[model samples]
Target: MHVFLPDGKQLDLPEHATALDAARAIGPRLAQDALAATANGVLTDLVTPLPEGAEISLITKKNPGQAQSVFRHSLAHTMSQAVGEYYGRKGFPKEAVKRGVGPSIENGFYQDFDLPEPLREEDLPDIEAIMREIIGRNLDITRADVGKAAALEQFSYDPYKVELISELPEGEPITFYTQGEYVDLCRGPHFPSTGKLPTAFKLTSTSGAYWRGNEKNPILQRIYGVAFASQKELDEYLERLEEAKKRDHRKLGREMELFTIDPLVGKGLPLWLPNGTVLREELTRFLREQQFQRGYQGVITPNIGNLELYKVSGHYQNYSDSNFSPITVDDEQYMLKPMNCPHHVRIYAAKPRSYRDLPVRLAEFGTVYRYEQSGELNGLTRVRGFTQDDAHIFCRPDQLKTEFLNVLDLTVLVLKTFGMNDVRFRVGTRDEGGDKYVGSDENWTAAEAQIIEAVSEVGLPYSIEPGDAAFYGPKLDFVVRDVIGREWQLGTIQVDYNLPERFDISYTGEDGQEHRPVMIHRAPFGSLERFVGILIEHYGGDFPLWLAPRQIAIIPIADRHNPYAEELRAELHAAGLRAEVDDSSNRMNAKVRQAELSKIPVMLIVGDKEQEERAVSVRERTPEGHKERKGVGFDDLKAELLERYQTRA
Candidate 1:
């Protein structure tokens, strides 16, 4: 049989030969270094037989994906064996504990266990000692298949594994891996031995999780651990974790007295504090001004509407479970609006009839509610009552491409203004096996084609996500990576063919006939609250000059300089800048420190020397220090700060 290498070179080999065997044929050195292989771009164990005409590439320790998976999987087994030995040393039988599944996740691995008693936090160090001892033993690892009956007998003491064995489909292979006295049911291309694991692995934390993710099933104790291919990588990951914790939005929000979430009130309902409300309003006004410049008319609607409204829009049929239950009126049922699309559709359908009025864009910063599960609710990412920066464009069929391109331009503006340069897009398409979306296939094709063309014409970096579209139509989403490299979905633009049909929307055509106007749904910021939450963390509570709740903080070196500080504050306020004077009875150093902690973008220190000269000493927060000062005329300072504020970032 023939196979192709990554470089497009073809090689003849024995039919059904294993990847390891193919590696040996390539070169003795390659076979020695090959940890795994990717057959036709799909990662697989080296023991798996390669098919004819497949593209195979050997994976080594330098391959991040292969190296991390191999090390994390091995760490799980090592931790499991460590736990068993720890219990044995405490005079407990090995059979007293049963194991659940452990697998490599995105950043690490976790093993679940069914124990007689919950493992305490203090038990982790002892287990680590045992894991180190096992690593020092350097036991060789091997893999083999076993019969279902034999697997069940070997794991009889572990009901979890026995259950797993019983659930195996007929004629399916059950694989196992053994190292030292530990054996686990795993399909793996593990490292050659225990010594191959990085010495930098560490157990992170423990949590309770339901078996098989079913809440009704037995709760198992889960231990999470992280492993890296090198000590430098491990140290970097640990440092990032610490930085993430320090900049966690929930923690900073509290410290800055911004927002609060009370369990007694509700799980996902966040109450904005006075300071947070100021921030939210600033963002709303900012977007509102931009929308006005881009030809969007503001509109308002009620928070709750009749149930039939959503049913007609197809949201109630598909997303009913995620919404709040219908409110029982005296003789009818009404539902709290879970989305603004249905309401926006009603507005469009009200008194519309001309092609000249085509491409009508209506926008709203409307707040919607959802019933998010308690466990899924994070700070602002997942919330019940949050506002969306939503808008809908009603345009002629021929105008679809232009409208989509316009929306894309607006989304890019939002990203660039916030200094988020690493923005990528995803085009979501319909799933063939899923519902056909109760619209004509012709309409679906037209909408999908328009989206593809518009995105392609923009010449931006993007990918396609199959089966990720809305039920009504295909869409494109914008995602941005934060400072620590976590991707967040920030904006979306969707083309809908079903909504116009459902709402019976039509406009008079130039040929004197009624024609359906294609609808484009867009949210540039997704949500002001959520975006600000991400921004708070992304900037570490140090907002840009314009977006800061207090743009400038004026500090007076002595009580005598308070008048000069207040005078400067009044001038900035008159110029439409959010400026404040520090009137606190504290030392000059303390006042400056407080302003820095508050993250006021620009600080002006007024002493007798500066006050007499009608000037201010400026200190801007850069990644460098603040001791470096620049003196400028008060008028010049105001002009420069205003320019930065208007341009943002």
Candidate 2:
């Protein structure tokens, strides 16, 4: 048989030979170094038989991404073996532990097992030691296909495996792999021997999971582990993990008293506290003013809509799984609105538009709901109900590019104002030959080309990602890297040509004929709850002066000066600053400590000399230690502080 190399050279091999044979024909060293093979982009084991005229490329450690995935997959099997070994030494039978699927995940791998006893966090170290020993023994890894009846007999002890084999498609091969006294049902592209595997892996934690993700199945214990090609990468990842714990939004939200989820209210429903409300309102107010300046009219929509409304937009078909179930009032099915675009579409169709009103921009801070699983819900980032800084533009067909660029500029402005400097764009195009999307071919093509053209015109780097677009359109999504070097998907702009056609909306053209107007959907911050969560972590809870919920604290040195402290608070309040007086029985030091702990931007100290001189002692919080300016004139301090806060970071 003949096979083609990556450079388009042909290699002749014996008929029905494997990829390893092709590698050996190329060079002896390649065969020795080849851990896996990619034939025409299909990743497979070195021993897998190659098809004639296949495009073959050897995957070694030099192929970082593919090699790491293969290694991680094998590591899951190794961990499963170690678990069985550890249990055997504890006087349990070999069949006492049954294994479920073991798959490679982002940054790591996990294995699900049904064991005789529940595993504790402390048991991981000993099991991990057993894994090391298994690797040291240098066991050869081999794969083979077996008949369905034979495979069922071999895995009779594991009902999970039995069910898996029974579910395989007819006429499909059932494959399995083996190591020293340990065999598993797997289709693998693994290292030739355990000795070739890297030891830079650690089992981090354990949790309970169902056989699959379904709640009706028996619970299995899942062990999570992370691996990398080198120890340096592993160490860096561990450091980032530790820092992430310190900057966790959940912890900070509770400590800072920003937002809370009350069980009585419901899970995944966050109730913004007074402090959190101020932070949320500031963001909304800023976006609203920006929209107003950009010629956007504000609008409000109902929280629930008729089921037929969503059915028309096709969101009912695409999002029904994640969306809340409909409620029946007077035998009518009313759905909690899952998207703001459908409502905005109705608004555009409400009034007859002309070509002169080419671009009708409508904006809203609309709250929407989705039925997220309890397990998937996090603090604020993943919630059941949240508000989006959403807007839609109905423009003439010829104005699509201009409207898309305008929305892109507004999104960039929002990110830049938040100090998110490291932002990149990803253009999400439709997946080829996919049926999940709804749109005509010509519309999809035009929409995607316009988005790409607009992004390219901006002269910023962007990547084209297939299967990332919405059901109705192609989108440009902003990925922002935070201070901790973690990326978050923040702002997005989508050009949609399907919604207008579905809703049958149109505007009169210059030719005195009606024409369909294209729709541009944008949200600077994807959602208020999620954006605040990312912002909290990005800033590490030390918000800038302008965004600070409590901008200033006024502390009295003694109870006798309480009256004067109240006067300062009133003055700051009248100046449009959020200020409070610390007139409680706490000492001066306690008062200052309390203010600093709250992350207040400024603290004014009232003393006898300051009161007599009509001045005040000022202390400001900065990234560094406190900056103090003593005995400043109260009038001067107010002017300087107001200017500083107004300047904003």
Candidate 3:
């Protein structure tokens, strides 16, 4: 058979040839340096048989993207060997530690094990030492393919591996890798030898994970590690990870009294306290005004809908796995709403429309529910229930770009208003030859092209992502980087042509005939709960004055001045500011410290010196700590503070 190199050079070899053979045929120097090879854009082990007419590129350490994964996977095997040795030194047999699967993930690799005893944080160092020793031994990594009977016998001591082997279909290749005294069942694509691996790895932590992510499966301990090309890169990532720990929203949420997830209330449902509610209200009002300016009318929707509604919208058919099981009521099935688009569609179809109503905009802060796995639930980012700032625009085909651009403009404004300036979009189109999506190819292609043209005209960078689109049509998703250099997928705009057809909704055209209106589903804040959680971490709990739940904390030095503080509070409240007076028995300094801890944006302290002139001393929180402005007149201060917050400064 003949194979091709990257530059289209052909090489003839015998039947059942491997990449290693092709490398040697090309040159002895290339063969010696090759760790692995990329066959038709997929990285593969050199020992794997290369197909006829395959385009291949031998990979060395120079290939950053492909080589890192190769060595990282090799490290997983080496780490497993060290784990067994560690257990051996502890006087435990190899069977005491049952191994599951391990794979190279982003920035790291991990292996799951069913251990006789749980591993502790202090034991990680010992594991690392054994791994380094194994790598230093310069053991060769070799592979072999075996028949099912032999493979089953080889791993029969381990039920996990046996179960895996039994599940493989007939005629599938079973391969195993060996280095020194350790051997394990795994598919190929590893480094040439253990010594060739980089030492830039750390076993970060360990947690319990189900064998295959099913709650019903046996729980295995999953050890996580981070790997990089160099120690410098690993060090930088570790530092960022430490910073991220400080900015964790769950920790800050409790400290700042933002929200809580009570087990009794449910796993993913968050109960917002007063301060947190204020945050949501402020964000809602900000976007509400923006929508009002763009002629969007707000509407309400039910939390649950008839099962038939989702069937017509294709949500049930295409996304039933993520949706909760239907509720049977009087022989009628209803489901917790998985999306707000179907409800918005009914609203548009409820009334008659003409060419003047070509673009009917319906918006809602609609709460929707999904059946998220318990293991998949995070603070607010991944939840079972959340509210969406959803809006659906039904416009004429000719007005598609204009209306999309209008929504895009509003989305940009919304993100910018909260200091999300660094942003990019992704055009998620349907996967070709896939049964998961709805709509015809012609319509799918048109929607995808319209999205591309729209984002391109706006001159924002975007990348095409196949299989990331909505089940109904193509979409454009926005990803913004936060202060700590973490990128988040916040908002999305989808151009859907399938839902309207399935629902049979239309508008009268200028030609005096009923015409289908192209529907654009948009959510500027994809999930309000998630958006707030990101904001909490982005600002590190130091919210801007306008967005701060408690904008001001008023303190009086003496009880005699409590009445004055109350007066100041009422006055600020009337001016639409969230203000509270610290009338607790705690001393004035303690009260001021408490305000700082609560992360209030402003503090006003009144006493005999200031009360004599009906004034207050102000302390404002800034990026560089709090600044004090003494003896400011009440009228002047009130006016200045209100203007600054009103302007969202």
Candidate 4:
């Protein structure tokens, strides 16, 4: 058989010749340095048998792709071996440990073990020592194929592995890798030997995970570790993780008194405090105003609906697990609305329309509910109930591109108003072979093409994501980056052709005939609840002047100046600014400190001298820290505050 190299060279070999064999045929030096090979673009172990007429490239430790996963996966096995040796030395018999699956993940790898006793933090160093010893032994990593029955018999003592093997379909290849005596059922590619394990790996943490991600499954102790090709990359990743920990929104929210999630109230439901609500309402109002100017008519929809609505929308069949189950009464079933499109469709059909009214844009801050697993819930980022700043536009087929452009513009304006730049678009479309999506190919193709053209016309950078589209149609999701370099999908604009056809929605055209109207679904702030959560982390809870619940807190120097502070506070409030006086007996410095910690954008000081001059001292929270004291006229300060508020600075 003939195999082709990436450089277009052809090599003739036997049917079962391995990549390592092919590399040796090419050159002795190539064979010496080859750690593995990329066969037809798929990574392969050095001992993996090559298919006839395959394209192959010999890969060394210097290659980063498969080498990383292979190295980390081997490290996991090595770590497991070390763990067993360490526990055995501590008088725990080798048979006392029952191992689960150990696999490499994005940044590192982890192994689940059913240990005789739970592991302690103090055991990590001992485990690491054993792992290093194994690495020093330079144990050869080899693979062996066994029949299903033989594999099951070999792993019968480990029930988890037995279960895994039993579930594999008949006639499927069964393979295992062995580094010395520690053999695990896994598919290749692995490093050449244990000696190839990078010195930059570290055992990070231990947690409990279900045997196979099912809550009802047995919980196994999971040990996590991170590995990289070099110490520099490992150090950089650790630093980024530390920075993310400090900027975690949940901690910042509590310190700022923004929002709270109570387990007693049930997991995944967030209660927005008064200040957090103010932030939400301000965002809503800002988007509403911007949307109104761009021809969006604000509307409201019910939070629950008859089950039939979702059935017609096809969400009932496709997303049953994510949504709340039905509530039945007198043979009628209702579901907590998980989306707003069906409700908006009824509104569109309420009145007869002509071609002049083809593009009917309806907007709403609609609340939605979904069942998020308890284990997956985090502070506001993942919640069961949240409000979506949703809108649906019904337009003619030819008008799809223009309507999409308009939605894109609105999304950009809304993002920019919150100081959220660095935005990109993801054009999500249907998978060619997927049965999960709705609509005819012609309509799907048209909708997807419209989005691509719109994005090009708008001159925005975007990526085409197959199978990432809505179940009903193609979409453009606007993603933004936060301060810590984390990316989030904030705004979205979708071109939907399935819903109108499903609901039989239509409008009278200029020719006085019925025609189907294309629909564009858009949400600038995907959800107020989630948007604020990202904002909390993005700004570190330091809201902008306009959005700050308490934009200015006036602190009196002493009790004698309380009346003056009250007068200044009332004056500021009368000027339509959010202001408060710190009337507590706490010291002025304490008040300033508390305000700063709460992330109030500005603090106004009222001293005897300032009162005498009919002025107030200002301290603004600058990126570098609090600004220097500057005294300005009370009215002058109000004017600047109003200017900033109006411009949303």
Cα lDDT, all candidates? 0.85, 0.90, 0.90, 0.87
| Candidate 2 TM-score over all chains jointly | 0.94
Comparing 1 with 3 on lDDT, the higher-scoring candidate is: 3
> Whole-model lDDT for model 4 versus the true structure?
0.87
TM-score of 1: 0.91
RMSD of 1: 2.9
* lDDT, residue 355, model 3: 80
Off by over 4 Å in 2: 4-10, 16-19, 22-31, 41-43, 59-66, 624-626
Model 2's alpha-carbon lDDT is: 0.90
- Best first by lDDT, ranked: 3, 2, 4, 1
Q: Model 3 compared with the native: what TM-score?
A: 0.94
- Writing each residue's lDDT as its tens digit, candidate 2 over 351-441 gives 8999998799999999999988777789999999999999999998788888888888888989998889999889999998878788799
Error of 1 at 554 (Å): 2.5
Model 3 collision count:
0
Listed in order, each prediction's TM-score against the native is 0.91, 0.94, 0.94, 0.94
RMSD to the native, candidate 2? 2.3
> Which portions of model 1 show Cα errors greater than 4 Å?
1-16, 25-28, 62-67, 120-129, 147-168, 214-219, 435-441, 627-632
RMSD each, Å: 2.9, 2.3, 2.4, 2.2
